[model samples]
Target: MIDVLIVDDDKLVRKGLMSAMPWDSFGMRVIGEAANGEKALEFLKENHVDLLMTDVAMPVMSGIELIRIVRKRYPDMAIAVLTLHQDFEYIQEALRLGAVDYIAKVQLEKERFEEVLGRIHGLILNQRRKPPNEPASVDQDVYPLDTAYAVLGLGDHPLVNGPRQHSQGWRVEADGHILLWTPDLREELWTEVNSDREWLPPLPDQALDADWRLVRLRHIAGLTQFDLLQMVRNYRQRDFFYDCNGYETNPIEKSVQELQADQPEPSEREIEAVKEILHAFRWVHDSQSFEELCSQLRKLRLPASKLMQLLYGFIVDWSRLFKALAKTGITLPDTFLCWSEVVAWMGGFREVAATLSGHLQLSREVTVSIMSAVKIAHDELEFPLFAVDVAKRVNLSRSYFNQCFKAIVGYSFNEYLRRVRIDKAREYLAQTAKPIVWIAEHTGYADEKYFSRIFREQTGLLPSEYRNRHRQR
Candidate 1:
């Protein structure tokens, strides 16, 4: 039988999950539950959990960190994340760290949650592929969601965060389920039944976070396994790209349509600008902070062209990220898609900052710490948070965190952060299919011309051309 743990600070979430059903009948059993990630990690060291269902945001230790540690030690561990809609960034980070899926706690009731769990349990049970290189875990029960499910919420969650993990119903019958919905459910929870008027259990008095709930949505149907998986992937991608360096705030669907209204590029231009920008930015460039160049552009010395003439020497940043991912042969996904896709699949400014800070540096721990914070900031879409602040969140120190990060990631805090923002702009130009002006604002570069110049330098292709070239399938 599969060994699993249910983690959530809210007592109701925990209680509802616990009483949902006994896993032994479904080829699994509940091993334990923890209130927080720190506690969960401690439990993990002494015990083994084949699967994990956890909340993303929690005090002491966020679910993101817990997954990070778990993925490192147990890559095959099946993971599901739970968080509020506002916490998409956290979900994105967790996705990148390898949580297979997420659920909006307010959405589905315990019954639906258990159904999804059954499907996930099915996927885990069905998986037979083993990493060719790594030693196989003796636990045959450990399984990850299929890639399709990873991006979808488990499978067709109407919302980015919902109970979409399960495709069909559960196998065994419950003796009796006392359906409970959290009293404070602000809005109707995602695609599930809430009609059961069963009184729900309350959260533990010591629960963390504000506004806990026990909820069940009513009348959920027409959801199949395939449809659900697609939904999860779509949401996963959206969350990943939501705060990426190049995230356009709008979808390429617009640009795809606009391509009809606007004329194609002049024959002479030929997207050479894109080529030039990429060529220029092979190294030295980071975060669109070229002052002398910006000064001249501000003075009207250069033409206001769509070409990314400013971006230069940014390949180093890309190189760093590329190298890191190559270690796993996993390509990071693009940011700026709609919600519900693979978390790592999204990439952008926030991603660049985190990647450059940690990967550009030679140091491992400092890089890891910075990566942790950047990831948190990216998940939250808030940046420039203090080093100390990031350190504290990741349970590190100002000095040791700095040292460890520098030692592993290979860039000092400031220098690496600069690279992150700039590279994010470059990526935006190439990936998001957004306008140059908008890309500048999102990547922390207010000046469009300067942003363009930096783009040209780093990518050797002007913003538009680079985008065109990469945009072509």
Candidate 2:
């Protein structure tokens, strides 16, 4: 049976999960339970666990922290995050940290338990069967080509009946279009009709069903199956950006190498222009300035990849500048697949920028006071600090200060204090050979054991273990 450990801060949640799930029938057993990440780590240290089911938010150590530590310490163990709909950002982090799957808490009762268990079990088995040292192959059938072939798009043609099987050559379907890669052009697939371009053939509408029509049929040579799919995607993205009528008959004669070489880095002038736009946008909230910025971006002739890189840099800057002011739940996609996606993201960010600009315009004084309080908190981490004391230092009532603090910082004063203290403790443990007791005392914990408990709760590892782990790294 697969030995599982369930970790959650809620006693009721842990007990309910343990009792409600039919573990025996699924060939799994919940051999252990933990109140939080720290307790989970303690249980893991003493027992052999095959799978760990954990919640995202908890009292001391967060599910993200637990997943990070567990992934490193127990690379063989499978992890599945227990998440709510609101915990999307945390869930993303968990998945990036090697979580194989997620169980939605809200859907647990609504969905079939057997199906969930079966899916988890299948994923765990697949993960175990993978070799540790090599990257997982995207497709087992992917093989290097001795001679690259031309890839053609056959748009929803009934000539090809099934998926991944075509008599002409290797076939792959993407976005309702069938892509075929062959050594030579098959004339039988198309009918000669009126065409402005000599190389292009006009598709016969009578041959297709009423539901289907011929889209663009162009060919690019020197591509493998993987490269063919990628080229098709690039073509689609190009079509979207250019607003092309699918009838463009021009063949893509440029090789993949040529395409790669065409994507140049943003020049120094472009970089400086972006910086100027960002500065102006942040400090000056004129609608005309926003329009000008968008116009300038649209006028650029940079490839989608380079444009995305520039935009991603802008996103990073915005993230750093408005981190405290922005809601903690907001998440931006790390990569954009096409120009349309980038445009959509920019539109969303425009709304966010307007909201943040309003905050800056109306709450300049509050922002300054909160920032001062944060600076004081950072500077005075060694001593006992309380919200009431910080509020007094910042010249505000305790309750009012808390309201502004949470509004601007996305965390309560006490929670932020604990996080900073533990963060400092972590730095000391990792960078220095200092005694655990001294580190604890210096980080505002009077008792070493109590400090260790809190540290474990935040990090899922004791001070010594954390230090040792970092040292090994």
Candidate 3:
């Protein structure tokens, strides 16, 4: 796979790029990301990456400077720049400095971003086929791959900040993981590494040769720090993949007949498991419970495609369930459009479980009480309702209620009430011969003038004008 690194100061952009793209389908993956060029450079020092996608402007070190340095040190690596509309000059300079292409930040929609990434993937693959142009002398290199072995620290592990070496290889403690590298290149040595519980490798592509499982074997001839870092990044990413019996099963190679033939009707116990997870989600607020739910999900033995389908079905079911609970004119968030977007962001079933759990856990208080309070407000519009009255009905202090309401409903309590009142007013204006005053009073407005003012502010028309324009006749 073509491993990529994203460098940007904007977290939103980082997340968007991370979640929005079809990475695996394009034969690429985001091995790591950095907020600025300095961090990006540091990541590069530890990982072997095929491509670098960076923003034009950043805090620590600018992308142009990074590009110039990368071009000098890693001449074979492909580079891309993310530029703003006003950064045309910078883009030109980046291209001159050795960047392969540029993407306008403002226009980074899903289609365009994938298109650019796919192009870069093709370029990288092509470049890999060609031989490296670097001189074949160890003396020219700062840390030549042939002599001194590179050591990488695992993240937050007990062995971190320490170094050890056997006659066979060198090992360094990372934060929590231990990275080992050696020039031995023996098949048995790698097999032993693979057998270790602490080692997590990429999902094996069974379609390829079995020897392919040891990724280091293919790259050891010209191994750089990037290669070592890339291996660690690849290992970490396996956590995001859906595991079946503790291994990755490639779904793309399976035939349609095999997929359809293996599908079995879900058992009652499996159905109940789904229900129990959803039930727990409504009350689960802490990360511990959320993670527990994710852990339980890994035990499921369904195929990856089937598992994804089941998760999407659950999201749809939950959306309808949530809407029904609200019992009012509440519109669900726009996130309902594609469940695959959620799955794509997560890469596998466990991640899907965690994300769904987190989403369901939002604003537990708002969901339980405001749902009932919404029904009260909608059904009791003619009785005069206020934010405090709704809060009182829900047994919440007005300030806390307003906060939860806004957090869960995307609108303040007052805003929701006004919206409801105006919507009902419009319906009556279109369907009945009632006077504007009667309509206002029925929809909870005490004064006809005040209703007219708010109605115009919301719908851009006076009540009579709206009726004349939209009434059946």
Candidate 4:
């Protein structure tokens, strides 16, 4: 039987709740109770209850604080917040602290209470199957990925834009609706679509009778369930909201075969570096003052760009860690993603650390990405590093690197280099009217016609138009 604990300060309320739910029918056994957060902590110290349902406002410690402490220490405990509707502050805090359900007293009839209990039971069962310290051998129980459908317009979205990192969701066309899908949001949609029973299966290959149907998507990223959970949670705002534009169905599964196919998966060096970075925030006392910790990063032998990638990766991981906390009845502020904007927000590390957070934003993980453009730009318009060689150095497939480089830097390597060379040639042209052939050679363009074509495409005017426009401006 699943063990349980109900914590509240009121004696009558505690007894009433114990008698209200038929614990046996829901596969639960009430094991204990606590009148305050201190008492709850004591109970947790002694017992291994599968779940802990508690009142938010209590003596000695608030329910949110209790949840926070539990999330930090006993991350395994599931939590539910029992508070009045008037406790709006507590409700938000409770959700951040990992409260699985928030039920008001006035609406707590036996029928509704039973339903809440069942969902709590389902959620708890899900939590028991996950633990942070375990290794790969213990990872097979990852949550099953579900199919989800969503509709996002090309406008501001809370779920996508997040405070720090912008979302890279793709817009796909189906039924004439422009759809945007982020793997993170897709995971939430998948869980919701699976948990909600309103769905009725459609006839196979009948073009989907309804506006939506359940989809089974594969978690082809090759992340374990925990990693997948972290990926979604990291991108989401604690108080994040999204628009319901339209919907489409998606099915997902764990990408075990894809991972195996990676032929020597992720390197141990990369994995070790990421691990160190995640644990870094713990060492730094504050994130608000990052310059104070710049030396610390240098000590880790991490460059600034590499450190940034690690920070981004950890932001995603911390978000996932919060999910486990939510399952255990601990919720963090939805403003959690604000940690990512630290560098831009704070002028330097010293200023931020003096305030608090002491550069604790992402706990400082090491992820290195080469900043070749910035390096190559100053030397000449045509970089000595060929496009293929640059791609090989970054350890990306030729095609994949081409796509990633363009996405991150906003231009293809050769394309951008050509543009720069052409622009330089334009300078020489307007300044002294150099020969087109000389300009082409300087820009690394084998064909003068090709150089002119690319220059016109980029500037929306031919090389001549560009020279004339610059003179006019």
- Where is model 3 poorest over a 10-residue stretch in terms of lDDT? 204-213
Model 1 TM-score relative to the real fold: 0.31
Backbone clashes, each candidate:
105, 1, 20, 48
Write the residue-wise lDDT of candidate 3 on 141-172 in tens digits.
Answer: 22222222222211212223232223334333
Best to worst by lDDT, what's the order? 2, 3, 4, 1
Top model by lDDT, which number? 2
Per-model TM-score, in order, reads 0.31, 0.32, 0.32, 0.32
TM-score of 3: 0.32
Prediction 4 TM-score vs. true = 0.32
Question: Any idea what lDDT model 4 has?
Answer: 0.50
TM-score of 2: 0.32
Model 2 residue runs over 4 Å out of place are: 86-90, 137-473
List model 4 lDDT by residue over 191-305, tens digit each: 6646664543232222223232222223423333333222222112110111111233332122333222211223557556545644443323334424444333333433223
Which lDDT value does model 4 have at 290? 40
Q: Write the per-residue lDDT of candidate 1 for residues 317-378, one digit (tens) a residue.
A: 34454344334333333221222232223224335444654555534344444545544433
CA displacement after TM-score superposition, residue 36 of candidate 4 (Å) = 1.6
